[model samples]
Target: MTRAHGEVGDPPVGKYEEPATPEAAADRVEDVLKLLEGRWKLMILFQLFGGRVVRFSEFERAIPGISQKMLAQQLRQLERDGLVHRVVYAEVPPRVEYRLTAWGQSLCPALDGLLRWAATRGAPAEGVSDS
Candidate 1:
């Protein structure tokens, strides 16, 4: 039996390939980027990376300037993409919290490296702070 590595469904250890052209490579990166492309998606994921499950309002607050509508949209997209999980608690207030899925959690190390590199560069991505 072939062992599944993780969400991408690759074997335990394997190489991933796509069409070799620059455009193809770009497209492939864009595809994965789509999984994290929304204005608040990465921020949301980053906020949840510390194993802390947070409510939607908490997510909005953590993101600073993101609107509720955009937050909802981004969360929905992340949920649909299978990178984030929403858990609802049955209670009077009906609490709900968002956390990263296995795939999303796996991105932490890579994201950390990217953040470090971006910090060294002059212009860091929005939502990512120099401080």
Candidate 2:
């Protein structure tokens, strides 16, 4: 059966029914959420949003109390998800910098909205207030 561009599956969701891509585009949102599911993803994105491309050590310092292993795992996941770009510079000690990808930057607005909502919604029942 013929399918239109940017459409997925047979019979389509409406007037369009293009074949799904090999990369599985349907799970993009879920994947993005999963990428952000970690404790440090949002914090990392926030740091990157400030227009600072930070070296590996600097990134670690920005995230208080985050374990080195967790940071490494989250950074690897972010890299795999195309949400962050890792640049390696050839120098003594081999410098590596991390910055958000375009897709990652797009998430800033949504994150901000979510933050605002949470601010008004208050903390969870079991949550402790910082103040």
Candidate 3:
């Protein structure tokens, strides 16, 4: 069988080459993990998952205990990573909103799986304990 480019079963082309070695694979994983290494990025992504565009104040309210500086910083990072879209509207008071990009929306399933795993494993295993 054959598949067309960008089809569901089609192999990745262009710069999407697979890692050549175990070390390279690990490096790739590390790179992704680094992109998502902070406490707030996933939460920010989760809030943006439901197709609702949120403003800065809304995000501040939704995520309790996050400072304005921190929220702004995280949002900037997410925007840099191409996972979030920031739209600014010119109005009397200046309005800005945030929504997930297509790349960000693509992470929904993986986030859902993580949520499920966390729900099922609420407590730490034998030798593990909260830090």
Q: Which candidate is the best by lDDT?
A: 3
Q: What's the C-alpha lDDT at position 41 in model 1?
A: 81
| Top candidate (TM-score) | 3
RMSD of each: 9.0, 12.1, 9.5
Candidate 2 lDDT at 15 equals 52
lDDT value, residue 69 of candidate 3? 94
Whole-structure CA lDDT of model 3: 0.78
**lDDT at residue 106 of model 3 (Cα atoms):** 79
Worst-scoring 10-residue span by lDDT in model 3: 3-12
Give lDDT tens digits, candidate 2, residues 12-123.
Answer: 1245355387466666556556767888887877889845687778877888898889888877777777677777665677777777767677778998898888887755
Question: If candidate 2 were superposed on the true structure by all CA atoms, what would the RMSD be?
Answer: 12.1
Give lDDT: candidate 1, residue 5: 18
33-88 per-residue lDDT for model 3 (tens digits): 77677889888988999787999999999999899999998888877776777777
- Best of the two (2, 3) by TM-score: 3
